[model samples]
Target: MLDDEARRALSRWTVGEPNAIREYAHGAINQTWLIETARGSYAFRRCAQGGAEVVRQNHRLIGEAVARGVPTVAPVVVEDGNTVVVESGRVYALFPFAAGVQVDRDRLSNNDIQAMGRSLADVLEALRGCDRSLVKEGRYEVCVSEAIREIDRLLSVISELPPGEPSDENALERLTTRRAWLVEHGVEDGDPFADFDRQPIHGEFQDRNLFLGDGKVSCIIDWDNASWSPPEWEVAPFLDFVAAYDKVKVAAFLAGYRARCKLPDERLDACVWAYGLYRAHDLWLFREVYDRRNDKARRFLTPGRFKPHFERWLRR
Candidate 1:
């Protein structure tokens, strides 16, 4: 959306003509753009229609993270130094361009992949230090309970999904059983361990949002989904790759994560099961909504191509 207003904002911030402008709204949520000014490139994000406070809190969190030595995009508050600027009824923030390469499966190495886990742990620890009281509370978009329930809903529709293979049916059944377990006995809040656990999160953590440079994680972009939530709850996305990549990669990730953040003994062993049923199921939903609909990758979703990769990822 490189309109006159956005260009004016860019000019006001950078104080120069933008050489180039790129729009990147690939995520299902929020609006994003990149502007290349004569001075430098800048990243821009406009909050979703219903999410003004979320972006405001995220701006506070970004500043807090910077103060704590964490890598993240800093929000450009309005002219008045407010975290968000409402223009034409849309909320937007401009940030200094981050330095790094977007991570992909092909570009990731054993160590490079493992580093992401460590980086996640660092983000968690730093987030803990931030004043959680400043973070707005209520209806966190990525809460575990709500996420698990959505997976259960997906499982209910699994069999009805165009009559796929028997294994697909079995996959849904296993996931459903797992969800039932969670609803029945898993921690439903009010535990000491749950202190920082259900605090805040980046919400969606994956290769897409991660960036690497100079042999280390330079920045973790896309703060629109950052919310108060659990710590390792951030790791679910990398664990989702089990359906497409080898277990060794997933292991490398967790090994790095454990080095920084340790899952409780009870949650550790079961976290792997989460490594399986619930997490796997949610990724499938993500794939249906994300990959299958992507204009560039739409053809990959034939009658039954992605399931085997999911199964194969699991066997490994």
Candidate 2:
């Protein structure tokens, strides 16, 4: 249920305010609405408190890229020349809906992986050229030492997981074995941050953020997690999805990435450990939440997703 006052304020704030019929696209920690206006169907997102800061950086990055002719969504500037407006204690901004196709599991490919790697490298390079202050830094750092600390957090969480929720027998063993192996072997020099290129990274540069059209990365969306971090961290997603089938695709992505940013072998090689534990914990976290819901996602509360995946990794 929305109101006229909210609509009028939004109209005064953005290009297509009045005739812009809006519908909820998502209503999570923040609110994202699809607004159809004379300007076109654009995305209007509202965030309060901490979200305001992130929206600022999101708009700044998009504006910077558009100004440089790099392909990205442009935030709509209001008649008052502000790209964002705060009204009734909420921060709101409108962005042109990014063009391209939604990526699906079946759409994964070596070419797509390589293209993803290349596009991230290109966008990072573009971001590096801007005034660094426009991008804000967060409290935590991504480093090998830091990664180990995060692993420790995951292990402690594992120890405290609800009694019946551990992985399936095979997956449980694989998780234990890999965790032990990583604890012993992964602490060496092969972290991606060693001599890494730094930037205002589109922090979550996974395939879901990629909008592909006609065989290229048409747009990267969802700046919710954008942060200033080593560009090498962008290597994780391409590695995670593709390494399930072709390790060579990860290799191709790295090769394409090197053409733009020269990363240390340590960081590139660390993709395996980084991606492995990342998926393990990420899947575990998803299960934790999904198990509490009534949706079909509850089917994943068991080891169905992890057993085969972990077994395959063990065979490799």
Q: Give lDDT per model, in order.
A: 0.62, 0.60
User: Scored by Cα lDDT, where does model 2 land?
Assistant: 0.60
> Which candidate has the highest lDDT of all?
1
**Candidate 2, residue 252: lDDT:** 69
lDDT of 2 by residue, 1-316 (tens): 2465456556765464445555654333455677666767777766643656667777787778767655678777889877777777677777778899766645677777777777878888877767666666632323345444554554555565566655433334444554555565543444334444457777777776678877778988766666666665666655555454355765667777777777776655554444554444333333343343323333433443223233344454
Off by over 4 Å in 1: 8-14, 136-196, 242-245, 264-266, 272-314
Cα deviation of 88, candidate 1, in Å: 1.2
Residue 43, model 1: Cα distance from true site in angstroms = 0.9
Range of the 10 consecutive residues with the lowest summed lDDT in candidate 1: 300-309
Q: Clashes in model 1: which pairs?
A: 197-230, 199-228, 199-229, 200-228, 200-229
Please state the error at residue 133 of candidate 1 in Å. 3.4
